[model samples]
Structure formats: C-alpha cells, structure tokens
Target: MEMFRGFLFISIAMILFSLNLSNVEGRIHYHKKQKKGSPVEPPTYAPSPDDPVSQSPSYPPPVSQSPSYPPPVSQSPNDPPAVPSNPSDPGNTTSEDCVFDVMAFGAVGDGCTDDSAAFAAAWKEACAVESGVVWAPSNLTFLITSTIFSGPCKPGLVFQVDGVLMPPNGPDNWPKTDSKKQWLVFYRLDDMTLTGSGTIEGNGDQWWELPCKPHRGPNGSTKPGPCDSPAMIRFFMSSNLVVSGLRIQNSPMFHMKFDGCEGVLIEKLSISSPKLSPNTDGIHIENTKSVGIYDSVIANGDDCISIGPGCSNVNIEGVTCGPSHGISIGSLGVHNSQACVSNVTVRNAIIKNSDNGVRIKTWQGGAGSVTGISFENVQMDNVRNCVIIDQYYCSTKACQNETSGVYVTDVSYKNIKGTYDVRNPPIHFACSDTVPCTNITMSEVELLPEEGELVDDPFCWNAYGIQETVTIPPIDCLQDGGPEAIGESGTYGCY
Candidate 1:
C-alpha cells in the first residue's frame, strides 16, 4: 500500500512540471512575433511629459484633432497664397469712387454757362484723396473764367479732360474783377499729371484787334493804352509735372508759360494761332530747370519755344515749327537785369516758312552769360536768317548801344541743311563788340537761297570759332582765335 501511494505522488508531480514548461515556451514565441511587427503598428504606450520631440506639433496630428488642415491639391510652389476678396480694404478702393466728375459737382456743360464753381468743387474733392482723378466728361464745353487751380495736393493726382475748355469770348465779355494777366493758372503742384484729348480755346479775336498791338495802328504808330492780355495757361512754382496730348489755340498772349518750375515734361502737343498775332508765343519758360519738350507742333506769331532768364538743362526734340519765330534763347536782361542760361539742346527739328531759325538775341547792357548750347540735325524750308545771334536786339528803331552785354560762349550748330529766304544772309552773327562771343563751332551747314541765287555772304562780327567742314556761302568772317577780353561789363555768374 505504501509503494502504490508513492507512485501516485510522482505522477502528479510530473504532470504539474510539464504544464509549467509549456506556458514558458508560449510567452517566448509571442515576444518574438511582437518584435518583428513593431514598425507597422502604432505605439501602444504614451510618451513621457519631458520628451521634447513627442510634444512638438511639427508632425501631423490625429485626424479628429486637426480640423483646419487643408485638403491635398496640386499647385505651383512659387504661387502666392490665396487672399480674401475684401472691398473695404484701403488698397482695394474701387475706380468709381476715386473719379470725381465735374458734372456731379453741379457743372452745366453748355457753352455759355460758367463752370468755375463746379470745377473748383471737383478739384477740392480730388485733391483731398490719396490717388484721385478729376474727370471732364466727353461731348461738353465748359466756359471757365480766369481761375487758379492751386495745389500742394496728395501724390498721383490726375486732371483728365475729354472735352472742350473755353475762356470768355472776348475783352467785352471778360469779367472786370478777374486779373487779365493769366487764365487757368496752376500753382504749387507736385507729381501732378494733366492729360487729355481736348481743346483749350482762347477766344482772343477782339483782344488782338486792340490799337495797342504792334503795328495795328494807322501807319504803324503806337497808341498809348494799358494793354494787358492774359496768357492762356500758366504753371508757377510747380515740380514733377506732366502735360500731354492737347490742342491749344487762339491765345490772347502767350499760349503756355512755365515759371519757377522744375522737372517738367511736355509731349505730343499742338499749338496754333494766326501768323500775324502779336505776343502769341507757343511755349515760354523762365527760371525753370530739368525740362523736356518732345514731339510737338507749333504754328504761331511769336517764338515757338522761348527760353527766358534763369533756365538750364533744357532739351527739345522732334519738333515741327512753322510761320513763327523759331526757337529763341532770350530777349534777356530787359531793363538791365541779370540773366543766366546754360546746357540747352535742340535736335531733330523742322522749321518751315519761319521768320528765324535757332536764334540767340540779347539786349544791350545785360549781365550774366549764356553757355553750352547745341542745335543739331535741323531742316529749314524758306526760313529767314537760318542761324543768327543778335546782341543788339531792340524793339524800337532808335536804341542806345551800351558797353555792357551778356557773354555768349560754347554754341554749336551741326548738320543744319536747308533753304533760306534770299532777303537776308543765311548766317548772321552780330555779337556784342564789348562781350564777344567765343567757341562757336559749326559743321556740315548747307543753306541755299529759296528764291534767287545766293547773293549775300555770311556775316560775322566779333564771333570766334572753327568749321569742321567746308560750309556753303563759306564763313570766312569768323575770327580764328579765342575771344578778346570781356569789356566794361563786369564778370557775371549764374544767379
């Protein structure tokens, strides 16, 4: 009985040992499978609070947490990000709100009604904005009296005209309270642009017929009266201005004038008047600098382009002038005031049937100097005195000759070829005896008589220069050496 009991105990012990060994083997196999499949499965445990890489948001969050994530779409890498279309933003101001129409300001577009008040209202609103346009609608004519468009306005201001602008009909209709010196004056403006396909008509027929005009009286006599005719348009003390694409006609006096201005540009303009009209200069500039006038046409009685005192750095190109006094430097130093001009260039011009071509005239007893002037590639047709410099320019028949005069130096003429009137010499250089002209250069000049044969030789008095090539009607009269010492006129400098 003891032996049987011992056998039972041994069997039970063996069975229990076998079961324990099987459980250990199964745990080892499960661990091996988990190690092999680790890369494909998500993490089963949370990260520690101190792990910086696990806390960072650079990686994508879970789908339920990331509500603002954009959908996958194809786009260029360089393209800008999309923005909302918000009209209330200052940068997105609409064009309709920026345009200030004159009609909206209670302007009557009829030919007779006065529209100065409406124009002033429009200008006030437009000038107040950051970038504004003052618009004159099409198919209308607005009569404006002598008015001033004053400004120190915001930048990017534009005055756009698509219609006609007319002044009072004649001197009879002119308002007595208005000043007759200027009409349509623009003052104290910067970065302003005046552009239009329009007409500015100055009804000056009666003003021109006044007896005070030169040679208008019987037998060319002067009738004593206060003769004040208004300039059509004048710009004063303005900078960085542009005027383009307009037609101006029939001015009482000067068509357009610029005074005390800088950085001015004028292009593609047309100016016309009767050839016999008095004091109707097309474009005049005084005390102005850094100016450019290009691609324009002028047919007027007086000078096409006049450069007055204190002007420098002027450039004129591609201009056509007819029936007018061709481009003149000055009737400077009137009443013996100081005048200085320098660095002027005129190129690629045509002067046809004009009174003079490329002239420099100064009154006697004038101070200061004119230097660094050039005229190149000019064509003249039936012009009188194709190239001239007259130091003794006087309006009256009898004038006193003074010892002091403006010094003229460094003038050049190149490639000037054309026909000239036979009544006067093609080239006349009547320089001041006291302040002789110096450094006058000429090249490739060929001027032939328009009517008869060439009867007169080129005239020169106290002018010195060299000719690079043989000229027609050879100018042997020019002195070969430098100018003589300046006479009693004291040394002058730019003011």
Candidate 2:
C-alpha cells in the first residue's frame, strides 16, 4: 500500500510539469507571429556633415512628426536615410540646399552699415548653384552703395529681397570710385528674377538740389556745369528677366532703366518722387524688345514711361500716371542719328494732372521711323496736350527747323476719352514740314475742357489721316490723302 501511494504522487507531479511546458511553448509561438506581421518603428538617422542645415549652427532644431502618426517606411541598412521635410525636427535627418542667405555671409543689417560687399559675396555663391535663391531676409534693412550684380549664372537664379535696400544718403555720400550713372546695376544675366516686398530708397533730395538740374539754376534754366545723376536701378544686356512687387522711390534721375535687354517683364511696381524732381522718369527703356510693363503706378517729374530708340514690340497696360509728363515715345533721332521704333501698344491707362499724354517727339535733323503705334482705352483728367506729335521737339529754344525728320506713320488712337487743361490744344499734330505724318487715324476720341469752354481747337500741321469718328473740337487742319513730299529732301534712309 505504501509503494502504490508513492507512485501516484510521482505521476501527478509529471502531469503538472507537462502542462506548464505546453503553456510556455504557446506563448513563444504567439510572440514570433507578432514580430513577423506588426509594423516596426523606424530607426533614427543622424544628419550628414555635408547637409546644409547642419552647416549652419544657428539653425533651429528639426521639427518632428506627431506621436499619433504611423511609422515611416523601413530603410535598408545600406540605403541613405531619408531627409526631413521640416528642418526643425529634432528626431529626423535635416537638410537644405542652394539657399544663399546674405546675412549668413557677414551682412550687418543695420540701416547704416555698408552691406554691398556681403551682398556680392552671397550672389557669387548663389550664381554658381543651379536654381539658387539669394535671400535678403525680412525685418532687416541693408545700406548698399553703387553695386553691380553681374552674372552669367546658371539658369533660374532669384534675388529675393524681402528687406529694405537704401543707398547712401544723397549725392554727398555717393562713392567717387563708383559709377555716377547707376546706383544698382544688373548686367549680363539671363533667366533671372528680381522680386520682393522691399523698398529701394534712393534718398535723392540733396541730389535734386544740384545746380545742373533743370529749373535749379537762375531764371529756371539748367546750369552749364557737369551734371551727372545716377538712375536708381538699371538692367543692362540681360535677357528673360522679371522685376516685380518693388517700391522704388526718390530717385535722383530715372527710377528704373533697361538697356539692351530682351524678353523683360516689369509689373506691380510703385514708383514715386516729387513732381519737380528733374529727369526723374519712372521707367526708361532703350534698345529693348519683347517687353511688358503692366499694373504699375508712377508719379514723377518726367515721363511716366519713355520708349527710347531701337525699342520694339512693347506693351504697356493698366498703368496709372499722375503729376508726370505721361507716356512718351522719343525725343528720339537726336543729333542727326537714325532711330527706329515699331509695334508699341499702350492700353487701359490713366493719366491725371500730367503735362502731356501719349506724345511722340522727334528731332528735326534726324532720320528713321515710328510706326504701328496704337493708344486705346486711355482716360485723361486735366491733362495738357492730351495727344501730340511734335517733330520739332527741342529742349532749348535754339532748335533750327531742319529739312529732314523722323517719319511718323500708321498711328491710331481709339476710345481716348479725356478732359484737357484748355491752355493747349487737346490734340496737336505738328509734324515736320518736309516729312509729314501719314496714315494717322482716330476713332471715339472725345475731349472737353477741364475748366471753362473749349477755347482752343485741335491743331494739325502737315498731318494726314482719316477721322473714323468726329473729334470733340473739329480738327479741320488735317489733310485728306497721303502726305505729299515738300521737296527731294523728304526722302532719307533709316539705318
């Protein structure tokens, strides 16, 4: 009976041990299945030393993903780690490229310091990189001297100017070693863009007081000394350029000038100066082609926009001009030189309190042609000489009436509704005696006196065209058929 009891106890112990081993095996198998099927947390990556964000020690920490988000795709041990979209993430790899910050290159953004060297250095770095951005960060002001940002850079470079740019305070501080004709010049660039919510302050009050400036001398005449004033900004020999969203003000001379550029676009600019500022044209383009200037406001002493010699295929629309000389073509063909301008269209413009609206002036002793010009949908308010073509345009009274002149032909005006100042004729066409204007057409042109009754009539001299619709004050002076040559001197070749 004792042996039987001992055997029974041994059997019970064996059964219990067997049940415990089975439970352990099941738990192990369940854990293996979970390891094969469940998503695994991705490993953290360290940023490489060559990373742009890592190069700048002052950059903020990298931003991290939310805890509730799913894990990232698993990376192989041999593959490169993924870069973080947000560089401030502490747990992710951070990287940035091709953003050349001017402040990072030792620019002191105090409004008084000279930051031109720093800007040039930053531009050099940016120009070498493809599609790089040269950033002038916000909430800062940089004082620069006469600078030339020259480039034959890689495609798609951008000058991002979010901060204020100011020149030296007037003419006294202008650098003698630098050029006196340009404050900021861009040269030889292609496929570039200059844009920002920045202000380019010329600080031109003292420069305007120079004796050589117009009306600054005795008896409202210019003095005969050396008179050289710098334009605020100039683009030279560039192509496929864009300039927009800038506020340029108080220039000593022209606010903006473009020379020898093609495929240029300028829009949404605000340009202003005192009405008495001499030679302060808002925009001036010479030898440019395929240009568009739209949606801009300009108030200055000279022409709001001036089309100089060798310009073609220009379109100016949605522009507002006030206290200015209005839009002008020429003062071209000067000094017996040849000039050519064609295919210019100005539409949807407003000219208010200006000296002239839509004028074409050429010198007497010169040759070339101005053709295929159209001015449509223009509204004038208290403007003088609303529409004019003066072949005898001379700044001084000593201009001699030479036999040769720039031929004006194929010009049309439509929907030109306006009020004139009444001191001058609303439409004055004083073409050259030898070379008369031809094919001048007008339609829907209605002009009335701003103050009193219409005292002056529309004047024309040797101008020829057909009036599609009757003008306000009858222009009986215009000849009916094509222009008749006065003599053999009327024929000249335009180069």
Candidate 3:
C-alpha cells in the first residue's frame, strides 16, 4: 500500500510537469495534506493544449478485483475566490503640505544654521504624542543625528518632509561609524508614515576614503565604504512602516533599508543617488517579510532593490528604474551564513538604462535555497543584461570556488518583455555546473537585443515562452561605446 501511494504521488506530479504549467499561471496543482473529515477542494489549473497531459484529471486503470472509488468533482456549485495578499498598504492615506494635521517638523526651512536641532525638537515632540505630523518645510536643510524612530506605526504618527533633510558636508558630514548614529534613522517604529515633497541629502563626499577600502571587516568592509552614510531611513526590526510620496535622495549607503521588518509599504517615492556612486543600493532589504514597493523611481549604481538573505513572503510591483542595476535577490551566504529567500513575487516593473534587468545572483558556493520566486509582467528597455540567473557568482575573498559548491533551484519568470541595446551578453543563465539548477522555468519572456554591432547567442533560441519564446537580438558590448570620430570631441572615453 505504501509503495502504491508513492507511485500515485509521482504519477500526479509527473503529469503536472509534462503539461508545462507555471506556478504563476495555475497550470499545476497538487493535493496538500488535510485533516481527517475536513473538506478538500482540488485546485483548478489551466493546462496547455500542446501538452499531452490531462487538462482535467483522468481515471486510473481500474482495480478490477476491488470495490470502486468515487470520482473527483467535475465542477463546484460555490467556491470562495482566492486572494493573493499584496505588499501595498492601501490604508496609508495621501496628504499635502500644510494641509496635513500632524506635528510640523524641522525649523520651517530657515536655510540658516543646521536644522538638526530644530528637526530633533520636532521629531521628539511628535514621538512624545501618540500621533501627529512631523513636517520638513521647503528650503530647510534639516541636519539630524541618531534620532530614535519610536513610533506607534499608526497614521496618527505622520512624518511630512516638504523640504530637504540634508546631511552635513565634508568629512564631518560622515555618519558616526563609532556608533550607528549621525544621519536620520528609524528603528523599531510602526504604523508610521513618511510623506512629503522634499529631499534627504547626505553630504557624502567627506567619507570618500571608505569606498576605496584597501582592507576588509564587518558589514562587508573593515574600512567602511564612503557610500556608507548612516541609512536614509533605517526601520530595523520593526513592521507596518509606510513611506509614501517623498523624494529620498543622496544617502551615504542605502536610500532606505528596512531590515527584519514586516508589512512595509514604500509607494510613490523617488529614491536617488549619483550614478557613479558605489554601494548606494536604492533600497536594501534583509531578513524581512510582507513588504510592498510600488509606483516609485530609483536611480543608482547598485541594485535598485536588493532582496537579501532570510527574506520571504514579499511582493514588489509596479516600479520604474533609471541608471540602476535593476532588482535582485541574493549575494547570500557571505561570512558562512545560511540564508534562504523564498515566497516572493515581482511584477509590472520597468527597468531603463540599467546594468542588469532582473536577476537572482547567489554566492556560487553558499549553502542556501532560493525557491518559489516569481517575476511577472516585466518590461525593459536600453538594458545591458536583460536576464541573468547566476549560481556561481562569487564575490567574497575567502571563497574557494574550485572547492565550495552551491546551487539554485525553483525560480520562475513569466511574461517578461524587453530589449537590450548594449553589445554585451544579454542573458547569462549559468546555473551551478555541479549541482545543476532544478525545476527552473520561464514563460512568455522575450528579449530583443542589439548593440553597436551584431552579436548572437546560439544557445538562447531555447528559453522560456508561455505563448511563445524569449527573443534576443545581437549587438557588440565592446564596440557600442566607442568613439564615433577620431578628432577633438571624438576622443571620448575608452573601455
């Protein structure tokens, strides 16, 4: 009987796989374990016509010697619709400057001596009360340090920035690495909203020495990168945080890093940094869950959004990028860490003039599993590397690539449309050569790539397609950026 049950399970799974149904498109269904006497409703799947597998369940060849079993339902009279939880917090209401009924913040834009004292005063006041608007009015360069973000995480606690929260300039402008204080940050805050038509500038040049780290230490640098200004907004180990409709730019490191937090909503935010800046990931999230990032614009040299280790149950949708590295997961398993990223979805995103469009990059020889990840309805233009799934992406100095072996599994991409203009290799699906990637699937993904000159990938003809295949054009990454003329203006940059 046990052998028979194993056979039955394998048969069902095999039939589902053969039909080429993506996890996103409801092409596959399996029975989940249920309690005795409990009701069981089989999932509905949309199977492919080209597939020989059953669209509907078919009966097994009869057990001629035994009593007959009941057939599964053909249709149900009534069933509750399934609801996929989105990361967006719709309850976060929109508010305009001055019209807001919350605590007013930051010395009303005097443009004189640093407004840190004023900002400190207002923020402290807002915290003292249960709820209020904390405003950064126009023209104010609010300088702040080690401001504790103790919030009720409620709408009553509103943070409005109508002006600039600028970081101090020169070396003195650096966030005190001695302690994680210097710039404005939020920790253990909840149900709080940061909304305004203003800017958060960190005078970052003072710490230029950090980025050129010739040494190594904790947090990825012994000598921290100059880009490591205290975080723009650090919602550490907190949840239900909402940041909407604000321009959060010029951070030392991450524009906003929500670490180990849940129920985070970042909407209509313009998170920016200089394109040449290093380690300035627009948003870096790690060890968190239930987060939504939508309707936002991010321009940076690093990952627009870096979904780091131990992240699960995340939804990233409807975002646009500029001069970014696109969205990514992993670079995990650093410093002997066992990280797992799972149950996340990214959809309806546009990436322009970026290095890589959408990717999952893992430390080639780490111990972690990246599973059940979905990318849907992605549109790309002028992208350098349209798609990548690198399992052997090693960056750490201690890595012995020839010895350490890691693998990636169960990743899906659906309905991706893009054009790669640069001449480099657009798609590098170099999964772990040893422990090969398993159950990796793509559907309805197309890439039209062209550089200054034509270059093609012979192996690319066989990629994902729901209705059709992923398309790719040819261009030379090396030749595309060359000078058009040999004289004055033509003597431009070199490779």
Candidate 4:
C-alpha cells in the first residue's frame, strides 16, 4: 500500500509540471507574433509626451534619450503657427479679408478731378486678388477720361465703387475705349462681381450725335444722315460678369451691349434714354450665352431689347419696357450673312406706351435660324402694335434686294394681354414669302381694342419654307384700329 501511494504522488507532480511548461511556451509564441508585423511596435521604454521628434523613416529601436532626438528647428519672425503667405488665397487660408481703408487704397476722399490718379492706384491694388475686395467709399466724385484697364480677372477681384464714377461729357474729352470706362472691363475672367448702389453719369452732351442733317459736323464739315454716333458701355469677350444695383442714363446709342459674354446676370438696374434720340435701344446682346436680365426697367427710343445673331440660352424676366420700340429679336443681317439665335425665354414682362411688344424682326432675305423661343405672361398698355413679327422687316434704312434671305423658325407666344388702339392693330403676323416661319405656335392671345372704329385689315403672307398648314384667325383686330386708337401714318404716328 505505501508503494502505491508514493507512485500516485509522483504521477500528480509530473502532470502539474507539464501544465506549467506548456503555459510558458504559449506566452512566448504569442508575444513574438504580436511584435512581428504590428503597426505600433512596443517601445522598449515609454517616451515622454513633451518629446517633439516624429517617427523616423528608419524604424530602428530608439537610442538613449538625447537632445538630438528632437528635430533641429528655429522660429521665424513673420511666420505664424499655421498660415500661408499668398494673401489672395481663395480659401482665405490666411484669413486676410483685407481691412484696407478706401483712402489708404488710393481713393480720393474729396469730390474733385484729382480722383483720376487715386482711382488708378486703387485699381492696381485690386488686380492681383484671388479673392480680394476693393472699396470705393462715399463722398467722392471720380472724374475719369480715356483709361484702358486690361483684365484677366482673378477669382475675387471686385470694384466696389460706392461713389459716383462720372463719365466725361465730350467727344474730344470723352472716355473712349482707348481712354476711360476701361477701368473695369474684364476679359475671359471667371467669378468676378461689380456691385454697388452708385451711378455712371455719362454726361453725354458731347458724345450725343450732333445733327448730321446736311449740317456741319463736329469739325464743321458736311455729313449725311440724321446723326452719327453710338452708345456708352461696350463690353467685349468677357464672361461671368454681374452688373447690379446701378442707374445708367442719357446714353447716346444703345444703353448696354454685352458682346461675346457667357453667364451674365443683369439685375435691379434702371436704364433710361432721351425720348428724342433715335436708334437708342435699351440692351443689345450679341454672341452671348446663359444670360439673365431680370427685375429691371428699360425706357428708350428704339427697341427696349434687341437680340442679335449668335445668342443662346437667354432669359429675360420681370422687366418693364416703355417709351421704346419694344422687344425684338433680329434685324438679322444686311446681306449674305449667317446668324444662329436659339433657346431664348421672355416671361412676366410689362410693355407700356410702346410701338410694339413681343416682336421678332428678321430680314426678308438672309440665312439665319431662330429656334426654341418663348414669350409668356406679357402685359401691354397703350401699345401701337401689341405683337408684331415682320419677316420682310424693311427698316428706316434703305432696303437691299427687298429681303436679306434670313429665316425665322420655332417660336411661341402665349398669354399676351393688351389693349389695341384705334389707329394701330393689336396683331400683325407677317412672315417671309420665301423663308417661311416654321413651327410658330401662339395661344391665349387677347387683343381687344379700346377704341370704337373697327376697321378690318387682316393679312397673312405665306410662310415660305414650311409644309405645315398655316392659319390666321379672322378676328379682324390686326388691321383696323378702334375709334380711340391714334393716327397711324409713319413709324411713331398713332392715327
């Protein structure tokens, strides 16, 4: 029995020893695996939190704590902890919304002629802006002559002309493209804005067309025609330009012309014209795209709005037109010319006391296409011819071959409400006899005369190039005016 008891004790002791050895071996294997490919190798010793050294590319075991462990560095006088030097940074990473005072930026505080020099300096400071704003504070009248300021406008260089920019009023002393008004013209620039509640007084007495009616010219020489002159504002090959909150008046020619621009927003503007001036249109856009003219008032002698050839995606909304020839599309081309006008929308516009409204005037003969046009929700008061589309559009200027071979196609006129006068008919739809109007659809045309005399002068010329059946309603409201309608003799005569 004693021998058996000793054997049992020896066996138990052996089992216990085996279990302890297994635990030791497993721990060692696990620790080796953890250290083999871990992102954070267990440091031989914990490092101090104050240590400035970063992880070295050489992932060797750290040596003894030494001063060299920290990166060799120095402090810069101008350098901040976290900022960049380029002040015009788009992100404003430096957070420098330049707090420069107007006068400090070369703005003349006094209302005088010396403002030209100050304006020149202010413009220079605004040129190199990635996102910079230049101020033109109040209480200053800046007189500018012919000054040309070239522009490849940076993302955020603004001309905050808070004061008046008076345009010199003389042909010899006027601000021409070579001289003045070039102050803020941008060429092929993106994301630029000119916003202010100031005025651009052309003081256009000298610029106005002196009577060329066989009378002495500016040099006291004989000249032809009624007058010889053009407008004030001229833009060439610019993009993403915004003109807002401005009042421009007394323009010699067309008030505003946007030539070869894309993405233009003209809003909250009041443009006027001298009622006696001839051929003075409100706005003329040529070869432009994605343009919007909204919430503005235009009063001029000629057409309130004229869309030249090569314009697309244009929108005119919430506009008030008066003392003008009304809205027109194309005088097309003179001869042997090509034009493409498409994708235009005019809505919610008011036409008052004008010769015509919602008009599309193309030459009788020319090569052009006007498509995807819409005129909706229009109101006209005391309008001579509320809606006029003259394809054989012979202007006051002499005719060439009777027609210019231009074509008008794809148009719509909906919800046009107006009161026709006695002398002038409410609707006159005259398409070209050769190049007909195609896909021209009109609906909800309410033209009832307020005058008593109802004479019937209804006419519809053939739509030359179309196969669809064209129809003219027999309302007889187009030809004869009501009793109260004015006399109709010449272009402006209301009989």
Better of 2 and 3 by lDDT: 2
What are the lDDT scores of the predictions, listed in order?
0.80, 0.79, 0.58, 0.59
* Candidate 1 per-residue C-alpha lDDT over 1-495 given as tens digits, one digit per residue, 9 for 90 to 100: 999999999999999999999998878843333220011221122333233322112211111000122212111122222211111122222244556767767677788989999789888887888556676665789899999999998775667676799899888889999998899998998877676677889887788888999898889976878789999999999887777778899999999999999877777889999999999999999999877787899999999999999998787888999899999999887788788988888888999999999999999989888888889999999999999999999998887988888888889899999999988899999998889988899999999999877557999999999998998879999999785577646247763
| True-structure lDDT of candidate 1 | 0.80
* Residue 289 displacement in candidate 4 (angstroms): 0.7
lDDT of 1 at 61: 12
Candidate 4: tens digits of C-alpha lDDT, residues 1-495: 999999999999999999999998888743333221112321233223243433212222211111112111111122212111111123222112321224553444444454555556655555665544554544456675544444775665555555677655555655334433333334555555555556666565554555552223566454565453445566668776666667777765667787898777677788887655566778889988777777789887788889998787777888999978889888775464667777777888999888888888776455667767888889888777777777767744566554335555556777787665656667677865445555555567676665664643434454322212222223332222112221111112110
Measured against the true structure, the TM-scores of the candidates, in listed sequence, are 0.80, 0.80, 0.67, 0.68
Q: Please, what are the lDDT tens digits per residue for candidate 3 over residues 392-462?
A: 56654665663232345456667777778556566666654444455555567667664455544622221
Runs with alpha carbons beyond 4 Å of true place in candidate 4: 1-102, 105-114, 175-184, 213-230, 402-404, 453-458, 464-495
Clashes of each: 0, 7, 25, 25
The runs of at least 3 residues in candidate 2 whose Cα sits more than 4 Å from the true structure, single-residue gaps closed, are: 1-96, 486-495
Full candidate order by lDDT, most accurate first = 1, 2, 4, 3
Cα deviation of 25, candidate 4, in Å? 58
